[model samples]
Target: MRGCRYQACRHEPLVVVYEDNVVDRNKKRWRRNNEELPVHLRRPEVVRPSRPLSVDQWNQFAWESSQASLVPCENCGRTFAPDRLEVHQRSCKTPLPGAPRKLALQQVN
Candidate 1:
């Protein structure tokens, strides 16, 4: 006769329980509690740097080389390194050639 073979199969039925919902509920409750607290009492947020902490010297060299191209100033037409372009542009008094002229206000007669 081919009946039940496993020994523990007749024991208490096994049940699977998932704790995902419980964890999510707990997180929501914690966040709500923190939000209710005053700013001074709340924990400070962590700050992270945007760039990598330790860049290799070779990688740094490659990055500088890639960005080393000179950019022409729109006002003076003079080329400056990408990093210095902004500083040069700020002090450049020469206006762009053939640029539209500003209209002068006419005085009342």
Candidate 2:
């Protein structure tokens, strides 16, 4: 079969290992989970608990939270508590190229 250097997986007629590794890992995880569950409850279909974030809901909730402590980072654009911002503004050595600098820099510039 033809092979490419940059391509990680080759569809060769010989041994192909990357696909095998994925299948083997999935099989091992399934076996482990199957062993953990009781014999009577060993059905093909089982529901698992997962946590999913809703961006709109989270954003709305965050905006509604107390306005006193949160300030959007002039460097990173992340919202951090005022105390954290205080330390970050003083010590955050990573420069912000395009964004406006914090209040203290305006006087110097």
Candidate 3:
């Protein structure tokens, strides 16, 4: 006969065993016990807002400040926000310096 692998084991096999059903039943019992507690004694449920309350005022202020600081394009005379001016100017039809005017003149000659 083979001896048990564990020194403390009195059974033929030294492995421990647990039933899944017993563990699941214990978890369900714990949840049911907690749910049965008095309303005031239980922890309050947390509610999260879609947008945070604190950032609203700061965001509004920043928008208004940026709108106030808008600069007009010298070539087109159209007002644009500073960040968008460069992109708009790149495609503007107005004659700006460093365009292909010199190349066109050379082609004509």
Candidate 4:
């Protein structure tokens, strides 16, 4: 298959064209979120955040999140699951100038 001439050329940024009715509705939604209207006239706000959790709850959440997260490798600084990081370490190499070099992380305990 042949590629377009523009494939490798400098391309322009995207232009989005929305219809008039859609634009007007989006404008109204923006205004509603920005300008405060009377409670009766206001759209019922669906509150997303729950009441703050206790200190123990917060600690548990932080611990769980840390354990579940994909942490950056010391050498590549790219994220990997702890189990998968070893596999990446064996093969992760970069030759690009100014790119990061991988290093081993020292364990504290």
TM-scores of all candidate predictions against the true structure: 0.26, 0.27, 0.27, 0.28
lDDT of 1 by residue, 1-109 (tens): 4456553564334321235566567767756765776453343322234465566855765565443333555655565554466688678787667765332211111
Per-residue lDDT tens digits for candidate 4, residues 1-109, read 5477655442332222345467678767756753554332233322222668888987787666554445556566666655566688798775467764544233311
TM-score ranking, high to low: 4, 2, 3, 1
Q: All candidates' lDDT scores?
A: 0.51, 0.54, 0.53, 0.54
lDDT of 3 by residue, 5-70 (tens): 544464434232345466567767755754775443233222223465578876776676554445
lDDT of 2 by residue, 1-95 (tens): 55585344544623557766876888678667656654532334222224554888666555655342355555555556544665776765666
What does each candidate score in C-alpha RMSD?
21.0, 17.9, 26.1, 22.2
lDDT of 4: 0.54
Task: State the TM-score for model 2.
Answer: 0.27
Whole-model lDDT for model 2 versus the true structure? 0.54
| Stretches of candidate 3 exceeding 4 Å from the true structure | 1-64, 95-109
Off by over 4 Å in 2: 1-15, 43-109
State the TM-score for model 3. 0.27
Clashes by residue pair, model 1: none
Clashing pairs in 2: none
Residue 33 shift from truth in candidate 2, angstroms? 0.3
Instruction: Spell out the clash pairs found in candidate 3.
Output: none
